[model samples]
Target: MDFSLTNEQELFQQMIRDFAENEVKPLAAEVDDLERFPIETVEKMAKIGIMGIPIPKQYGGAGGNNLMYAMAVEELSVVCATTGVIVSAHTSLCAAPILENGTEAQKQKYLPKLASGEWVGAFGLTEPNAGTDAAGQQTIAVEDGDNYIINGSKIFITNAEFAHVYVIFAMTDKSKGTRGISAFIIEKDTPGFSIGKKEKKMGIRGSATCELIFENVVIPKENLLGKLHKGFGIAMKTLDGGRIGIAAQALGIAQGAISETVKYVKERKQFGRPISGFQNTQFQLADMNTKTEASRMLVRKAANKKDKKLPYSVDAAMAKLYAAETAMEVTNKAVQLHGGYGYTREYPVERMMRDAKITEIYEGTSEVQRMVISANMLK
Candidate 1:
């Protein structure tokens, strides 16, 4: 199969790279320090169509392919992982499910606004009691005369605090186990729906994450996403798509750490000579470059498979697992290469290290990714 990027893909990658370096990098530190959402930058991304890269133009997106989406995610992540998570959560977790499974009315009601970035979208699957076992979700939705009353809380939801819409999952039948779970579209302002306190996270500080509390929240029957008892399938499919974006985010963070390490080694003098002159440092840089390239290729392969409508669950899982672990490893080495400076906030490598850790933990933990890959292999 041909692997070269088309002219359009090349131009798209260049555009994202230029925007990240010129616009995002400048304000990343300030946003992180202040724990601000960077709404202005998010709006700018929307204007440039980075917020909806993979959706069709008719849905108010840039009408690009999954590869373009991954490239944009990587570039944005290199500059600011917070921005990358924002877009990834919006596109893959939220919009992808609706695009893939929603009825026409659901799409018409939600997709355009989410695609245009007029309002942010969030996906709710993980609960305080259930995470990797999403089928064990405790959130319940009971049918009530043309509406469903949802009751439960979702923890660790990305963009939960600021999102205008949410694609939520709740159990409709306890006896059916995984098949009992169903998906619903719930608006943020609906009665009995409120957000809990924002989570103080280890990294990606500029991205907002919070708890979603649903206390007998009523939603119209029309808001049901896909068929009842089919939410588990939708959630899994959505997460498979999300894994590719997370993998790209990991690649971007690794790239950023490596780039910083390279600059530091070149200018840092150790024992009367530049550290870059040391064979050990050179070997570390070489290994980092190789791993980063490999991670990028894995992400591209998974994305291409997704574009072709092929079974990409294994590819996506492998990409996320390898790339996230790679990010952690590279960032740790970057810190070591920088010596004492790497441990301080004075260097971006430290922050990158913290950001890299979450990539492994969220969007399915590294362990979960391994399980997915192994399960696929066994089949």
Candidate 2:
């Protein structure tokens, strides 16, 4: 088997790395400091086709595969996890489902705009009580003349206020449990669809996380994403792919932290010599770098499986679980290596540490990833 990257993939990776360092990294601290979303930069990324890395060219995307998408997320995340998640949620959660399950007309209608970044996409599945238990969908959609009238709410939605299109799941037949669910494409301009409370998160501050309240929102029948009552399957499968993005994101964060710490130790002196000269510091750096490399392998493994259309659920779960823990460990050590300066905003390690956390929380918690992995093992 060959290990070398194709010329196109290598060039794409380098371009994204250069863009992240020059464009995104410079604004990362300020965005974190102010909790401000960098709309202009996101649009710039759209122009460069980062927004549609895995989307097919026919849909106005970059025509790259899942591996390319993973690399792009990793590069963006090294400088700014917020940007990483923004692109991830749009591609993995929203566009992916439409591409997979959408009717030909639905794809023709939504994919181009989504791929072009003319419309930002968001996924709405989690409700107050329906997070892990997706079958407990409280949002109900009733059949109306030529449409479905939906009334329910979703909390902890990323890209809630910023998204122009939302892939929402609601209960169409309450008695059927998971099979009772259905997915719909709801445009942001639809009447009765409104933004609710906003969540101030511990990390990924620049990415909007908020509530979506739909009250008697009328959605045309043509917007139904897939077979009726198949949304639970859709959501679960989409999450498998989304986890790959989080894994890559975590990998990049760990790398960013270790890289910063390495530079700091070489330049920072203690007693009479640079701290990096100490055996303990060298050991810690070694561990961090090792974990970073391992996490990258896991992410790439998952991405490759996805691109090949192979069974990737187990792979994704393993990757996400390991990578998230790796991020937490590596970032913690990076902070320790930097001493008090790492705890403060004076350095990027502190922010890197903060950003690494959500990789364990969203796209399925680390605990959930373990369950997924274990379940697959039995299967």
Candidate 3:
């Protein structure tokens, strides 16, 4: 199997890396400090087609494959996790479902604007009560003549406040449990749709997560995505793609931490020599590099599977689980390697360590990933 990136993919990766370093990285600290969304940078990303990496060209996307998308995400995430997630949620969670399952009219109505970043997109699967237990969603959508009245609240919704479109899951038949769920594409200006409080998150502060409340919101019947009572499968399939992006994000964070730690160790002197001369520091760096590379390989393997249209659910889960945990571990070590300086906001590693924690929590937790992998093995 070929391990090398095609020239086009390599060029795409370099372009993103250059953009991140020159544009996103310099502003990252300010964005994190103010907890403000970088709309200008996001627009730039969209204009450059990074926002729609995996989407089809006919839909105004980059016409790229999953591996290329992962590479772009990793490059952005290396500088700013917030930017990374914004693009990921839009491309992976929001647009992907509509592209994969929506009817022609649905795709025509949503994909172009979302893919071009004319409007942001969000996914609403996690309700206040249903996170990992998404099948237990209490949000309800009742069918009416030519429309559906949705009434429920979704919490921790990424990009909810700024998004112009949302793909939401609601229970249409409680008796069917998971099968009872249905998906809808709701525009932001729909009647009775409103934004709730924005969450003050611990990290990825620039990515706006908020509560989305639908109070008897009415949407056209044509807005339904996929067949009735099939949203659970759609949600899970979207997440399968999302997991790969999350793993790429984790890989980026780990790479950033390792790069920074190496610089610090070489420059900071201790005991009449550079810290790099110390055996402990050397060993720490070695371990971090090794683990990060391993995580990267896992992510690439999963992305390859996705590109080939092979079964990748287990690979995606493993990559996300291991890479996210590795990010946490590597960032922790990076902070330690920085000694007292690491704890201070003066260092990027501190922020990186904070950013790394969420990867393990979202896109299926580490525990959930293990279950997915194990279950797939038994099949």
Estimated TM-score for each candidate = 0.98, 0.98, 0.99
lDDT by residue (tens digit), candidate 2, 261-282: 9899999999999999999999
Candidate 3 lDDT score relative to the true structure: 0.91
lDDT of 1 by residue, 224-340 (tens): 999999999999899999999999999999999998999999999989999999999999999999999999999999999999999999999999999999999999999999999
Point out the worst 10-residue segment of candidate 2 by lDDT.
1-10
Q: Candidate 1 clashing pairs?
A: none
Q: Which residue pairs collide in model 2, if any?
A: none
* Window of ten residues with lowest summed lDDT in model 1: 29-38
| Candidate 2 ranges beyond 4 A from true positions | none
Instruction: Name the lDDT value of residue 102 in candidate 2.
Output: 96
Quickly count the clashes in candidate 2.
0
